[model samples]
Target chain A: MKKINLVLFFLAALVAFVVNAQPPRPAPTPNDTLNSTKVLKDGRVMFSIYAPKASQVTLSGDFLKEYKPIQLVKNDIGVWSYTSDAVTPDVYSYDFVVDGVKTLDPKNVLLKEGENGYSNYFEVSGPESAYASIQNVPHGNLQKVWFFSKVTGKMTRFHVYTPPGYEKMKGKLPVLYLQHGGGDNDASWSTVGRANFIMDNLYAARKAVPMIVVMPMGHPGAGFFMNPGIDEDPYYKQMFDEIMPLVAEKFRALTDRYHTAYAGLSMGGLQAMNMALFSPQRFGYVLPLSTGYFPPQIKLLEEKYADALRNPEINKLKLFWICMGGQKDIAYQNGLNCNALFDKFGIKYEKANYDAGHTFITWRHNLEEFAPKLFK
Target chain B: MKKINLVLFFLAALVAFVVNAQPPRPAPTPNDTLNSTKVLKDGRVMFSIYAPKASQVTLSGDFLKEYKPIQLVKNDIGVWSYTSDAVTPDVYSYDFVVDGVKTLDPKNVLLKEGENGYSNYFEVSGPESAYASIQNVPHGNLQKVWFFSKVTGKMTRFHVYTPPGYEKMKGKLPVLYLQHGGGDNDASWSTVGRANFIMDNLYAARKAVPMIVVMPMGHPGAGFFMNPGIDEDPYYKQMFDEIMPLVAEKFRALTDRYHTAYAGLSMGGLQAMNMALFSPQRFGYVLPLSTGYFPPQIKLLEEKYADALRNPEINKLKLFWICMGGQKDIAYQNGLNCNALFDKFGIKYEKANYDAGHTFITWRHNLEEFAPKLFK
Candidate 1:
């Protein structure tokens, strides 16, 4: 009876792999995960597997497809081989769907721990990739920004890019407290703006002066669990009372107005004016790119900087740069109006108009040009 | 029957829009389609309907579940209105879900253009914006690279930028051939890479030398339907023979070999070498950022430039600049190998090691630096 059962099991195994009178597939061994990275002659990705009995084997993930992958040809050495062309610029999930069950490639190196079994992930290259900027120049480290706001309680984010030689220097670097527009947090400049890349290139080229950049989230309570009241609350007051102290404590930062700067785009641009005029003590360089002073804020501007608008110390700033998009209407005639007001008050400010609409391209370039001129 | 229907709707509307009433909704209006432009004022959006006798009317879209929306109140003008705090940027499809039946907003400018009906879009001041450099720079123009490639046997895409006063010149401007990386067409640099913006900024700041930049499709047969042969296709040959002549003919360009420049990254960088060295008479300046000479092409290189690799003309043709990524192993080492060879051969060249992985940020910055140096 035992012999008969063994024969029956052998026949079943034969039926599983011997579909077209071909030799039976070899049984998979525990260490079949041995064959690893292989680069094809044409730079294609090649890898080996030991799925001896997988009738339908495919590499499905971010780079490849799911479940049913292209068959990997089995070579004489009992290993299955597959090669793939490179794909897009992000991490993708893939699994070796053997017959029916899903499984990750046992050979890949980069993996993020997750709940429902560890899924396989691969990194595809970016054509004009932001992540690749680290190799071209010395990138500023990204340290987390935490601050307690009186208006929204605790927990805020600011990303700082300190100039090179910052850690060892005795004298503090000048600070540029930059803010992002709406919808974006502290991450916008790094991701889409490629701010680090721009700064790295500028600093390397010696065309721009090096300065510390502080990018803070415009919205407060952004990561709040139950209720994120960031957009609803006006945290301009919080900027003065809360964020400044937190940043100063963390980095080798300049303290007084002479060495401090304020800048932002769109909503953040509106905030730049707010920082310079409202606090009046924290910043020396003021730049509002793409958006300008609001109609309601016109009255307050006179009251806040009545004596200093013309003096290089007041709103004139070290570099009171105001700019707007030629196509954008939100800050449309707003720039013209701001320039007119500055003219009226003898504010002695500088303003430029760009031809395109309001976008990260313009804002970053504005800084790429403006930063070198500041604190010079 | 119509009178009875109107009476029923009005009766339902009173209960629906009492302001803070239970089960609040807006009444249905005569028109269809949401006019977001008008409602976008007050930095807020409002729900409205004209249901004369409805108890309640509501607004709902993909953002909501089961069509539960904030209610509306009946104004003196008979329009039911409910003011909402500004929503973020995205497309939304809302329906009245009136008395149980679903209906869309009639007054929005954003249309349901897709096959799916009832789609409305709005841009509520997001940080992601258009390029401002294109509009601000006076000497630059964003023109399309239109060419019928004899190799690809199809019309390919490219972008051409000429510095200010480019057209006024009696003599032709110096030409620089620039290429984008894989998976990206000519448009990638102009749009995502913001190449035009970078150039615009450089020109605006007067930091870059003004010249004409010609960007071509990086891949073979990208716009065409058929593959134009791989290694020995007559198509690539014709690109040098036919297409180059056509582009030179259409644009007022410097035609001599020393007057032309070539630059690209990765696959593009490889192509730059293929064009300049393989078809030696076509170009002068060669800049391959983060790319090595075609590895396997050493065989072809031996056959073609074997004797001349040691010659001065190989270097003296103009400029030969190469860049490499620090973290990149396969490609980085390959580029270094070629740089070493260039040194051994006494070729005049410049090599910079960028602290980047394979990325767009590296190439974009490289271009920002290189474009200004070309034709100087």
Candidate 2:
């Protein structure tokens, strides 16, 4: 009878373990019950955070003008809150500056990693942001691929997005070599730029041709840039020597100039411009966004590619597009100057501009607008 | 000449933009120059945080027993710092509790997403952690796959790892349906569990047969559990109905029972056990780490499959492995009591236990050991 009682108790303990086992979830504090962010029905966003000991709380995000951080008002219960004016429909990244230290919204799990730090991001979803939002359409597979870089002597990672029905597609796909900015990695375009979702929505809408988007690491090292010796840049060396060949072979990408395209933003834009000038016959489309080379690099390009820049093949590209974020963009003047040089060199390019500054907002818009025009 | 000088000044500004362009690289404060986490030469880790305003700072992580957070001492400049004792070479996740609020280390970019929040992770590299670390071996691709689940009626995401050279593999590959615990998503195994790297190293060393690893979302909703009426559970239904068929069709996976395996941890472990019991002929290998069924569920299984449990076919399973953490593990007693019932039903299984409690540390070790014995 004692043994039977012990067995029953053991069984009861087993049931308790089955019901109550886990690594004890992060205990929520008493005052942490409030939602930190709320996108109101009227397109206004409300931000809140609870920090009783903090002297100041402010909201800094891409939606704000000139990188300004707005202040939050604290209530009696130590929860600070802020309500914004009607914001346009778009995805935005933000961080809460608490007592001079930038902190992520503890209530928000969505994050976008930058070169220096990570920021919490949210979407004010509406019709305008429909292309970038996750829809009920067939989604693409984003592959985290690693390739050994002989130049860098490390296993570098990159991202590849195969569009819907790509696995069963009959013919080889055209490839787009997308590059991130100076302060981002390969994952930036897919995560923050919403490249996958954009493609999915575009495919569902029958607005674009299905293609493989390859995002590779642009910066070889901290200070590596496509400057005077652009051909010798480790990033360029790796892309041309290892990455491009791997993409062609492994992904069965179309290798002809008509099917290959190169596009990038900021520093990556500069790289794309260099790749276009260095090998004028390699890419059919070259798009550079929110970036321009310095005068010295432009001078080097003028001297180095004196023949290549003027060649009629350069004009034969399907698209040579250059875009900037209006006059307020940090690179606006620089881009204008670079275009002036291009005009002198008999280069042909289409230029466009948007109102957003040098941020992912402009880049996301750029991708959505340009991806459809590729492999046509 | 004056115009030429003005043009030269413009060139200087362009070069400055080239050199100093980016969303201003998250302006580092004067006091934030210290490295936030440093894995030292002696295998000790030193953590620092530049929180000048916080009153109390503490470190909480899996390495600390029973989830106890250790206090950090503040320096004269208000920087919180602590040096951990010699830690074994493995990956760890941690967070800084600042004034009772959990905060990530701003300087560290490596992050692991938990159910509620994100934690910064660092690695102490050594030969012992060689299987988990990113070695200079030919790595496989981890694809972020999306499938439409009728049960959940959403575009659910899962992770699939194809071994190195899988693109050119001649035949269909075996698959291990891996799952994360209650407090994680599909990405947890690849990121924190280091499942991809473990398989990579194991394949490189010829310790394990090359196989595809499929990790799916375990929790259908917040309070979803694999309790009574487990077959009707949405997670199980979705996995069997939608995800499995999609994998078989798209991945060209081997569908025979001998090449199929199911393994999970914590809540996922319980789900795996339920899956093995409910569909006894589906998986040849069943490995449930740090988990067991409750007594009522066991009684139901015993009553429903009284003849099936003692059938010789159940004994013909290639591997029925159950593992747990040592005495301090929350599920240790529950596992023993459940095994007692298995003995009464004449079930057979291989059990293993490690010293670490119910944490990823133990599960990682469990994977490193059991994965080699799978699909042999």
Candidate 3:
């Protein structure tokens, strides 16, 4: 009877070993445990960094006035964290200055390349910033297309966004020629502006028509749009002649002007104005966000295209929408001055005003408000 | 006469000031001045970090045998730099431990996400590492595609690479189903492996056929490929049923076994073996790099598909290539054992060996050698 009890005990121990032999759970990674940047529900942002040995850490960004650097306090676990006041809905770029060395937030992956260096960015969004937020809706496809640019004498790339159901549903889709700001390329609109998500949510709510959006690089060479001798007109010509034709041929894009629109932000805004004023018959709708023509540029446009602006056949524009941020915006006075000039030329236009100033939020709002009003 | 002379002197001074008024040159950023990592022409790598404040710095990486850390010396410019002895052609991940705190290369952007943290990676290339090097050729387009996976029940994303001239080309292209190793997503193969550039150069030299490469996530949920509950068969099924069908429908792809190939590295290699054995009819060519079936796995495969392996009609494989590093590799013995099993079963296969041990260079060399033999 004792021998039988010993055998049963050994069997029970074996079962316990087998049960405990399951794979061990993986330890949480630093990215999983650390909250480097968190967007609170109240539109405030909390930034943290792991620097146990460092004596001091500070945060600096363009969103702050005069680019002031804010100090952070250390916690029990050796993490330095700082919470900012309730900031408005906008994408902000920042970096951690640890012991006087500018260090990127190791926890944050969303980075933007700037003139000086790369800056980590986070978005503070609420109902007011709904257009840029991800919603429960069918998303569109963002494609990278590479083509030879005759003007640039090199291979260039552009991003094309085909609306949801574009593959299964076969129909000619209208195209929107979207452009990015200075120092950015074709990827800006979809990546930074969240244009595809914005369009997806708009389409889900039936607020906007489903159309293909084409974002092309505004600057093909190493120069800004406002710089002299950049000669953006030739690049624009190349777009209409080569790039647009290729886009239409490869994708299911309509070739007619009535099914085409042009929109851009900042330097892209300037390019859009140039395209509209010069090649008025190429696009039916035009929207220039957060950019306006100065007096010299307006004079140049009037002198160059007096007959086209006066001719109803060539100036058959369906919508000329101009959008800008509030009075605090650097371009606000310029926008007003340009509007007065447009009135003097008897050019009909629509305008939009947002509370934000010269930020992606303002441009996103412009896209949200303008995209729905197009192709009507 | 004195007043006139004074006015002339003042005019000369004003001219000098105007000449100097041209905008001052901006200071160089860390990326411009420091060479955090540089691959010498002779295959040696030099790494530098600008940490003047730190008392000590060391370099640690998988390339180092015994996983030892090497100390770095500080230069006059307050930059800590280290040059390693002639390393072989491969990609390596490393970090600088500055004053006992781990830090990434601020200048280097090519980073690999590991289980614990992100590591900065550098590639060493020469004539031998031709496939991984960026040769002057027409590059392919790397696209990010988002699709819903019914198996995972989430919106999964994958990257697709189309060879140059895919848009303009007028024929159905072959496809290569590529997979990443454990702990890596679909972006790993393209971003880290430089697969697109490899294909571009290969196609330019007419060594390899132009094909569409689809890289999909190996693990669907929160587990590694080797874990028990992470049954990769369903994920492979999803790839064949949904992802491949989508690729075929959207892109110009040939939908036959003769036009399809399969290859993967590490855990992905294990997956490739499983898929090729189970779904032999789906792929004509199979190459498992730096991974192979162990004795137990081979036994299981033989047991499950004894009749299928013996049947010539069902086992009509064009190529069964297995590749791994030298004897130092952890998987080298398993690969040999698997080959012996194949020999016993009268299965024909090709094998290649490299000098390295279970590194990306070994897998890259495998791809370089194997891709040329596919779809010929």
Clashing pairs in 2: none
Better of 2 and 3 by lDDT: 2
* Alpha carbon lDDT at B224, candidate 1: 19
RMSD of 2: 6.0
Chain A superposition TM-score per model: 0.59, 0.89, 0.81
What does candidate 2's lDDT look like per residue over A88-115, in tens digits? 8989877887777667677778887656
Please report how far candidate 1 places residue A115 from its true position, in Å. Answer: 27
lDDT for position B167 in model 1: 40
Report the C-alpha lDDT of model 2 over B1-376, residue by residue, as the tens digit: 1111122234444556666753223345644577887888888888888888888989877666555678999988778998988789988877787776667777787887756567777877888888799988988998998767678877678899999988777989999999887767787888888999999989989999989999998876646475643556788788888888888877869988899999998778888777666665888999988877666666776777676566666667789898988886766776887688778977798989987877778888898899899887
Which is the leading candidate under TM-score? 2
List of clashing residue pairs for candidate 3: none
Best-to-worst lDDT order: 2, 3, 1
Q: Mind giving the per-residue lDDT tens digits that candidate 1 earns over B1-376? A: 1111122233234324433455423333432342423446555666666544445555644323222355667665445666666544322334453333233333333322111122233334332222222332343444543344556565444566666555455677778877765434564555435566667667777777666777766555433111111245443554566546755765677788877888876656767655545555556788887766433444345566666565546655567778775664225755776666666666667877655445444565677777767766
- Pick the DockQ winner: 2
| Model 3 CA lDDT for position A357 | 64
lDDT of 1 by residue, A304-342 (tens): 546555454455366778877565434565567677877
- Please, what is the whole-model Cα lDDT of each candidate in the order they appear? 0.54, 0.79, 0.70
Q: Please, what are the lDDT tens digits per residue for candidate 3 over residues B1-376?
A: 1111122223323334444654322245443466777877776788888776667888877566533579999887678888887776767767676655566566766665432345567776656566776655676777777777777677766778888877678889999988877545676677666777778878988999889998887766665443111144567767877789888877789979989998987678877776566667888998887776555566666777676556563358798888887875656766787778677778787888876766555666677778888888
